[model samples]
Target: MQYNQRTDFRSREYNGRLNMGVDMRQPQPQAGSVHNDGINRQPMPPRAPKKKMGKWSRTLFATLFVVGFSVFLAFFVLESATDLFGLNKEDKQLEIVIPEGINTFQLTGILKQNGIIKQPVTFQLYAWYRSLSMPNKKYRAGTYVVNTNYSYDEIIYKLKSGSTKDETVNITFYEGMTVKEIANLLEKNNVCDADDFLEVIDKGEFNYEFMQMLTKNELRFRRLEGYIFPNTHTFYIGENPTSVAKKFLTDFDKKITDELLERMKNINMTLDETLTLASIIQKECSSVEEMKKVSSVFHNRLASGSSLPKLQSDVTINYVEDNIKPFLKVNNQKMYDAYNTYVCEGLPAGPISNPGIEAIKAALYPENTNYMYFLTDKNGKYYYAQTFAQHQKNLAAAAKAGAGVHGTTTQQ
Candidate 1:
């Protein structure tokens, strides 16, 4: 204690450098820290602690996952139902039948079962979509043809309409053909039986008022004889006779319009009378111009007030004869039937054959002429006569021209 050491660095250095210029009272820097000129750097920030999952949190996560998966599945199902991807393309020919009074679901099931449709529920949705575009859309019951190559829209279109893959036939009925001839032609074409057609034409009661006015007794021979209005007609291959006859009658009603009826009334002629005279004029003349002239001749004779009121049309006489020949003999010309213009006065009972529009117009409005008689030669050359003497001379000329007696009979 009496000999204490000196605290000064100079004294320590003299004592064999024991202190070595160090300070023992200063604080030290921590590990993993750098000191640059007595300045210390801070460490990195601490990480956050992980939270524990509770029962409610786990339920919420699971619920969200299930809802997302359900939405994805529902979208896939809807796309398939609408055929949005256009996947059902098989290109196979299929025959499908839908019975009467079936709902959309039943029809869809049937289509799917028949392999016509791959998805029933999807087809139902497709049908619903199609119905929106149509004004009145309803699936018809019938045998249908479905081609797999066709789109769903096309198949729905065919099903909505009653269109089917059935055999079709076109029957062209030319003008001037009689009802009997038409019946025979129908039978020959396998459209219907001749007897069935005749029966339907005779007994069928149409809704048209013009046809209604003409009773069974008023219409001679057949009720629908000259009213068929010959033209090209199309029908199903296995159509019924009554249906075919109805089509003909319907066409006739449309062709003979109300304006024509008014015109006939203005000319002091009934529908039956006009059709009858038109039929006679049609058979008498070979051409349209000749028909007008022949109609004039008949008009003159009717208005002539002569002792012989009979038309004396040779065709009318031949019409009543069985087995019509090219040349009618004098002996064969005598017929006791009311249709025989030679024996009967005025027009015949009814139309002899179906007349075209030209003949009908000719009968309705005859050409203005004073001529009372006309004759057709073998060459189809018509000779008109104003008086009896001129008619006799024309007859002599026609006989010299090698015309038959049928030509001579038409002269009177």
Candidate 2:
């Protein structure tokens, strides 16, 4: 048994292999290769390098984005501007009521609600801008008629002017009407109180070149007796007294043109004196032609030296008796003497009545004549004379014609 040991070991090894059922005869697959039962195996392909965009492509994309954004922004701005400025709106009238004492914000809100404005915020901004320059300017409250197409500036101006709903009256003051008559008319029309208007006329401080030249004579009955220009005017009912007086003065200021001022200077006549004479002429004559002739007679008497120093106007006596005496608390003999041309030398202390433009012109440019006296009959016919005897004849003729005589024929 010892001599056959090597052959026995080999026989044991073969038996151990058969018992385990182990086989090591298959080939191994390489790395990174697919192995599906080790049949038809293949390797994976390598990845390609990534490509980068060129400079021009990036620039084009950025340019397109910027252009698109700019177009959108421009369109937005155009729309906002159009609405803010009230451009291209419908032309339709709209009536709107603005409540009293509403501030700028409330005003714009009302406008927006009424379709009068599209952008309230922008309108308020504009109002604030204007307020910096005109602090006193504010939108007036009341019902107003506005157009839809009006610009912001126009809308603001219209609102600031006044309300259309306030009561207004048209008063026509005729030539030769005194301040008292004017006051009575105003009170009759419910424009203002007559006493208040007279108070303003006596004391109100009016600032005008012509008014500044006036002398505040205590003897003058009213401070602005003859300066109130006669015209048709519009006034608010129950208006302020000062405001009512200013309307008449403002018109007078405009009526005294540069040419008229030069004419007054050429004739060596002060404004008060010219108005005084014009007022006399206004009351004495019945027609424009008669006014010129009467103005000539007055001028002749004024230049007559010591022979005829006093105007001796009959109208001045009428003014004292008719206008002054009735209103006086006590009979002011001194005031009567100052205004009565029969007693006072030269022109009366001031104008007796408000004269019209034609009378004023006649005072400045009198008809060239040697006539020194004039008389008017009840029929309104005028007779002129150069001598005292001739005036007496004209007076008798006037008396025979109409049973009444009117002129400066009374003894001075």
Candidate 3:
């Protein structure tokens, strides 16, 4: 029965295979085919190679770039150099004022501001270079009439050469003249404008020792009334105001010798006070001898304290009337009080006139005497008196001698 069971199972398997007709074996591979883990797959396409540039094309491109850059650089340098030379500028006339003591940098700034030059740094460098070649050449301070089209060399030459023969004038300011009169004379001779000269007198910055000793007083008519030395000076036709002022101040600085300074110290008087007294003596006296005598009278009165305080000078009133009143907007009593010795005690607010050397010397070294008053006649003769009664007698005698009797009338 076991042999028959084994033979029956083999017979059943053969019968199932004949019924379905199925194949259980592996298939054969095809030619010209690749397999991935016994499976067929499609192949990928090939990639193309990259293109490269030629040598001649790259060389041409580089040459064009370099040429373009060179052209741009050339144009930039040419424009800057032209500006540095002050060429290619418009043909325009300009008037510029060069301040005193200005350095080269500040001078260039002024030129640039006035449209005379385009580049300040380049102009300064050019100036430095020119200075090395021409050591004597320098820029001057004054009013200049310059053309905008001028080259840097031409401008420098014009400034350094100074004024021409026709451009200079010799003007004389007489002694004892007021600042206003001096201003008028300067304007008439075309040295400078009167207002400009007056403005400089008030606000100009002078570096002299005497100028440094001055105090700022707003009530004074002209701050430098007596300081401007009277002299015959040659000046440019239209000089700078500050330069003109410096000319006068420089002369004053020289005139005040060391001996005079020591004398001022010995007298216990300031430069301002000495100048003020000198101005009064200058106007009141007719001759140098008379100046000393009149100075003694004033000095005597000043030493008497409150007994004879007021100077009572008639010239101060004349100054107020002629110079100050005409220029005032309204009647100012305080202004009159400031300069009129009749109203205020001690010296007038400032010097009434510019004193000459003689008058200044007279004020410093007055004739030692007991004189307290002085009077002048029409003949320019002076008479001195010690007491009020004697002064009245001299005044009467002066009046009897002629109709015109002038001078101080002070009381003890």
Candidate 4:
């Protein structure tokens, strides 16, 4: 091939071959320079320099990656820890029974089932951490009354200590006891002081609408007089006063169902009025059958345009006399107390006693009869009459049967 004017003929001979005898000082072609036919061509654009990394730069890159990864891992662990431990939830009093021979895994399940704890795994993890600190401390099996208000540490400590002082106390209230008497019974049982119980009954607020309505009436001797259901109750020994009242009121609410409320409404009576009549029937009657008769007599007197506008009940008068013997003679002069049904035109102001469900049902569904007079004698014999003359005859028969007249009264 013919060489161009600007071509270096010696450089062409060394192309694609090693030449040990080539001139060392020959001017080198710049990087990216273009050449064609050995003529002098335009120089190409200069390339960007390759960056060189030193020891310190490499170490900085490695440290940043490690720190970023560690921070991300720490944040993840914190989020998991929060969920595992029950934190920032509503507090409630929960009673749980932990059986004997149960492992930590099983105990965590029980606590979660009872709503005492939120997370099972978190509880286990916390328990594990605690066990590490106290190698000998372990949760004992028993009935545990735990409150959500307690912190995780407090709850864990309490479980480890095996405290059972929070056991429930049993309280029994008998039928026909007044609120005052009921308070005394609670005091005697060491459930609470009598005065404290009375204060709670008077001032404590209740959730039920029926109780809310009664709270408005200042004339009520006890706001929840007939509503404190007379039954056996088991409550935590140091239970709140409002909580104790709620237990009895809750039982009463269940007993006096919507069906019973509708019945009272059908008869054009309020709960207070119905309970008042039931209390009278409760005290006047000796048996359940007698209750129906007594309820009828009161219903007959309460009828529209009845000749006897007032219910001449001896038990109501006895209530005014503070339940004294010879109740008929205890109050010769008509008392001004509203509970004195003999003096009051209609039913008593409120319930004289906490009557049972039977009496309550009797008042709601009285025996339909024209009988306006009823008498229960000392021999437990019952006398019913439709007129004054028939009533006198029945009383004479009761006298012949060796039965004494105790609650005999004349209607005004």
Candidate 5:
């Protein structure tokens, strides 16, 4: 064989120097002598066993291997190594529709289950850190589209807002429901803070998040009474407190404006007065027809001028609702608060309760009638009386017509 050519094995020479594909210097063996460079010239001490690749090269390659493994390990920690790159590649735009008012704990669970996030803890930490750093805190509610190809940190940043473009969940509060009741419902499934939520409603405490979006003229309901409109609405999950409140108010006003207030002018009434009357109508009218008829009677009584009291209504007694069962007797005097028509004149300080569409319309366009007094039939239909004596007679007839209503004292 030829003495030398280039190969991976020969990197250095016996001259204590290096070569890059060309030999600089090397020892030559004596002719016919196997142990020339050694004790017996045994091939020059076996060329130092080719340096055995040393610990340094092994260490360098070991380090590179470890680093490559660590990168793979990081992916596994993020999401069980499910291949986020493939996930992102699969669907460039993914729609993750989370409902409104979902708590962080619940939201984290959902993200993991939905495969939107690789690690729940990672997401939680990421969101918390980002939220702290953010100038404006709290996530908004709405439909959103997310891409899954990102790493844990990358995904967290992308979804910091936690809103979606889709509308699935709805956050709603009716005007008539008490704060305790509303908060209880909201916290029932861990949607909102129970104690903190009540603070939001009853205390009128500002939710830092919601305050940012308040319209210039929109009034925040101090008492929260008659503020939350009773209706179903769409809300995105993970919305902050302020956004939740604003959405309720927005929806409430929308309903009232479209149906109640606009038609009020047609009926020669103001918004407050119309709502007040509607509350009464809602309380008094047992049947839908009765609601219309009773509304008419109240209007007629107001027009008569004979009764200067402007048709006193007692629904406010039921406004701050007490069960007042027929058998469960309590002092009649104590129950006669502002809501008692017998005690207070005109509409109670404000609307007794938030009225619905039918009630609102009844206030606007009551059925045409000349009757003054109204009583309930066995089926809760009204029996109107143009005269007081007729009203008394109808009352008796109504009481006799039925075996006395099991529960009484104001509820429609």
Candidate 6:
């Protein structure tokens, strides 16, 4: 039952005398055998050579190990020696351009290729260590010019932080652009979205807090389209896109000067009417001269005691949809709804578009004029008169000019 058992014979000499496997009746050796000691003379199965180590071997190995370990520790502890002995350019700058969608192991290889780090395995080890501290180290992909002067620690720090500041570009939007126009401008500039931006502008069902953001003067009418002042603004780091929009609206309120408001009040035009007129002025005039002329035409007409006191204009119909919808192009017969100047008696419901300061100023200080009727000549010059009969004469003159220019009589 035992796994290890000793031989039954006293020694090998006795076992050898019996030759092959012996039966129980085999004879034993004599008492005075040739053996001097009770031992086997067939040479004790060569005792395993003593395992004592050689003298020089022990000393040599200990010396080599001490020197090797000193070297390893020296490299590990001395920070500067990492670069001194490692396979990397001592003075080269790492120009790394990380394309999109590569995993971290591939990223380590890229660092190795650029000589940013000598060993990919060591780089990975450090990256893993960083991952332990911050599992989510998302550095945006970019082209970087990293100097070798920075230590491994600092280099990794810069790559992970991705602190690239885009050189700022200045973009300016005029005060009177619709939200759609603003969205288009932003889309063109590659900052934020056009559609989502439009959503923000359209989200005019403001809650109590944002409503409270308005000064009382701004609250005289609905919405903040024309209220945002237009000027050249340069955006750089720390420019929150959303906050910029809010700031624009705030600046708009500032431009609505007290003098302009007083002028509107004195003339008995409601703030709504003044802003509406301003909006029309903004659309009609490309220059200060034209703006003042257009403003005078409206102001004088409004002040007139005639039954046709309405400043009926085609722009009013376009303004009816609030300019959020596209501009309308309808025939006069179809436009004969109350929105039609030929049918309706007064101004449209709201401002057609946001009005800039120049437009507002023009509306406030209209040029004094007696022209009750005006028409665009063939060349877009204004031809003015005081009576319907005279307006007809101007129209006929325009027709004659068109005929003279084109050799055809106009039929209207």
Question: lDDT of each structure?
Answer: 0.72, 0.84, 0.81, 0.73, 0.56, 0.59
Q: Against the correct fold, how does model 2 do in TM-score? A: 0.61
Off by over 4 Å in 5: 1-180, 194-224, 235-239, 258-262, 266-268, 304-314, 321-336, 405-412
Which tens-of-lDDT digit does each residue in 59-136 have in candidate 5? Answer: 999999999999988866645434432243345557665566655667678667766665666567656764554545
Q: What range of 10 consecutive residues in model 2 has the weakest lDDT sum?
A: 157-166
- Superior candidate under lDDT, 2 versus 3: 2
Tens-digit lDDT track for model 4 on 150-218?
445446656765654566678788777888888777667655557666777877756787864462544
Q: Worst lDDT window (10 residues) for model 6?
A: 403-412
Top-TM-score candidate index: 3
Residue-by-residue lDDT tens digits, candidate 3, 354-412? 99999999999999999888888898878888888999889888988888788685454
Clash number by candidate, in order: 0, 0, 0, 0, 17, 0
TM-score of candidate 4 on Cα atoms, chains taken together: 0.58
Lowest summed lDDT across 10 adjacent residues in model 3 is found at 157-166
Taking the tens digit of each residue's C-alpha lDDT, what string does model 1 give over 53-83? Answer: 9999999999999999999889868756545
Candidate 6: tens digits of C-alpha lDDT, residues 230-278: 7776643223234346556656656666776688788777666666678
Q: Compared with the true structure, what per-residue lDDT tens digits does model 2 show for residues 1-412?
A: 8659988998888888878886546656686555766565566678897878889999999999999999988976675577655688898888888777878898888888988788777788888986774478667788887768766755765676564434689999999999999999998987766887897898877789998768678889988899999999998665656678889999999999999999989999989989989999998876997788889989988898888888888889999998899999987999999999888888888999999999999999999999877788889888888888898888889888867788774453
Model 4's C-alpha root-mean-square deviation from the true structure amounts to: 16.1
Candidate 3 residue pairs in backbone clash? none
Full ranking by TM-score: 3, 2, 4, 1, 6, 5
lDDT of 5: 0.56
Candidate 1 wrongly placed segments (more than 4 Å): 1-165, 215-219, 323-336, 405-412
